[model samples]
Target: MKLITEKAELFFDLMWSLQFFINTELKILTKIKNRKEYAALPQKDKQVVREKIYEQPELIDKYIASNPDRLNDNHLSIIKQWKNFIKGDFYIERYLKNHAIFVGDNNVYGVLGLHDAFDHLFPSNYLPIYVKTILLPFQGRIVYDGLMQVYQVSFGGGIKRSLSETYMQAKQNNKIITTLEKTRVKIESKAFVEVEQENIWTNEIEQLKSLSKKLKGGDGQPAINSPVFSLVKASIALADKALFDPSDIDALTKELQKVERAVRKVENTLDRML
Candidate 1:
């Protein structure tokens, strides 16, 4: 019955809403990848996560306002709950572990490496310039893309049919010229996965800010340490080291002990979060 657990649960609930949208996009993509059709999806893949970050309070309110006939009282109640939950302190990565979910480490890898999951089956090493530029954000620190890179070649011809050139990057990462725009095509390869990572990271950042707000009690007092924040920071760092620096196992092993100390420092608070 601790507020710590209550807060953590709220964070998880908000993240769950976003993660579900992400999973839905992945599922839909699995079935179809054609250009004309993908453009016509009811929900733009990135917008699903964007609404949670950008629209949030207003969007939820708008949904309730516009869909009076469909929403009813129960629907209104659910949206209220969601808003309140996010406004609280729940954290998805840490709290979910209490239930024996296989997250916080290797699981984080899969979620983080979603964008380049393609190169794993296709071995885009042939396009080093492309992959290097694209993978810059997440390359060494997170995900099993290096491991997946070896296996991309094994993907059957059918799986490799659609995006044989610049892959997913060329298809999605494009630019439209208009209104005095020069004839320049700076097609930056920003994939949907990149946006997803940013959303999750932003959510964690917001959680830290919320914890800071609460710990300071809105006064000028120094912010107290948030145990949930500590756990998340340490967990994310450890995940980065493990996946990115596999060769330096000894170094990571030593660092993990330090991370464990951090977790222990906030263990009691984390227990409450859980």
Candidate 2:
């Protein structure tokens, strides 16, 4: 399965714009706070400036209202959604918690807003399995926070191929794929193999144990001690075979099952000794 489908590209675009807006807003706030005049002001004046720049809601509302032409309808809608959520105490707490998941040391509204935008655009259930498998393993890493970074690293930098070109190449030639895409493909292909091996190994081990218990002699020794020991050895061998030679798994699993059934039949006929 492909990692970045057409639907996924739409979500990526939405997230990229949301993150850009958030980053720009943060930079503007930082510039205001760090201005020489703001710093040189008296404590009373500085407090007033801080409250107006940082604490006041009217400033953001006015900015959004004035910037309608600069932002598309979708962007405006997202900004309004953010404004509404920030007003609620519970939403503020959850937003902070969500921000903590992807970023460290930079817990600003931008990062929180970026996360919220992603959650809005693509709910967890709606994300592609391959994309989830790729990103979930590296959630703590900075590069895992957004698709733009992943796209850059996966495709290379400095005059490298565009996303469209790379995506086309991925379709034609799997050899030049990104590490993340390669890993996703590998995981997708091996999932069934791993599951089948695990099921066979677990079932055989349980069956062997059950057969051993049923064949117990009155002297507290297993009645078919030699056969039980051989089956135990065979179980281990089958597990090793499944791990090393998966192509032969079905046949090996069937043989083990046949042996288990034979042992069960013999054990059921044997009477308890005095």
Candidate 3:
């Protein structure tokens, strides 16, 4: 096991303690029914509230309290599904593995979207479903042709879940498109910067070439001592100073793994953007 300095671990501890802050600050967006709607659905058809929904007992409740105006049918379906996910009312294990059951092998979108025509290329589509990818308590709507909403509606409860309009949610699709473009630009920039850093450091440490001018004692001679002599001395000192303990092979390996994971995320995001 590689040891981390106590100071270095402080941030990890701080972040861990505040892990739930995001969920607390941002209201969970979900649907709930009113007494009238509850009374309207025939008891035979309306699924009864079970011990499960009462379990987390709080996830759905919190979500509902945040979004009270969503009595519409589309809202109810997603709410039920969300409840099912939290309560494991349907597929608990599958959820742990897949997030959403109907989405057995899907993508999980915490605050992202596949809100596009090409979303079909996404594996398992995305979580929150392509249906409710947007529809947050504060946020307005999903984009694209509203095609995904129609597709989501066609699945179970028909047109009730479909939204008619697009581009209503601050035009987030536009933001995502812009972000993707920026990410691509960033990658290109990194490529050039990386090459430049390598070259600069190489010049800083490169060894001096052998004296081009032969020195003859008290005779005609080219300069033996020159600018390269200074560079060679600096390079030797730099190489020594930069050397650090390499005993923690495992630690170094882990750091490399982290870099690889970060790169992978960037690559995946770029792929999605593309």
Best by TM-score: 2
Tens digits of per-residue lDDT for model 3, 1-274? 1112442243222222121222233322113233333334342332223222334536455545555444455444334333323111111011122112221122211221222222233344232233321211101211111112223422333321321112122233221121112335476567755664554544434432223123123344323333333334434443423333234556556555555554555455556656
How high is each candidate's TM-score? 0.19, 0.25, 0.17
For residues 1-274, write the lDDT of model 1, one tens digit per residue: 0124443343333333433433344453454444334434444453444345333445555555654335356535444333321111111111111120001111111112332333343333332211210110111121111111121223344533422332333223331111111111122223433543454455555555455444322255323355545556666666556544545878788778877877676665546655
Clash counts per candidate, in order, are 13, 0, 0
**Which residue pairs in candidate 2 have backbone atoms (N, alpha carbon, C) closer than 3 angstroms, thus clashing?**
none
Stretches of model 1 off by over 4 angstroms after superposition:
1-49, 52-56, 85-274
After TM-score superposition, what is the CA distance of residue 157 in candidate 2 from its true location, in Å?
50
**Regions of model 3 farther than 4 Å from truth:** 1-221, 245-274
Q: Candidate 1, 62: how far from true, in Å?
A: 2.5
Better of 2 and 3 by TM-score: 2
Q: Is candidate 1 or candidate 2 better by TM-score?
A: 2
What's the CA RMSD for each of the models?
Answer: 23.3, 19.2, 21.3
lDDT of 2: 0.38
- Model 3 whole-model lDDT (C-alpha atoms): 0.31
Q: Local distance difference test, per candidate?
A: 0.36, 0.38, 0.31
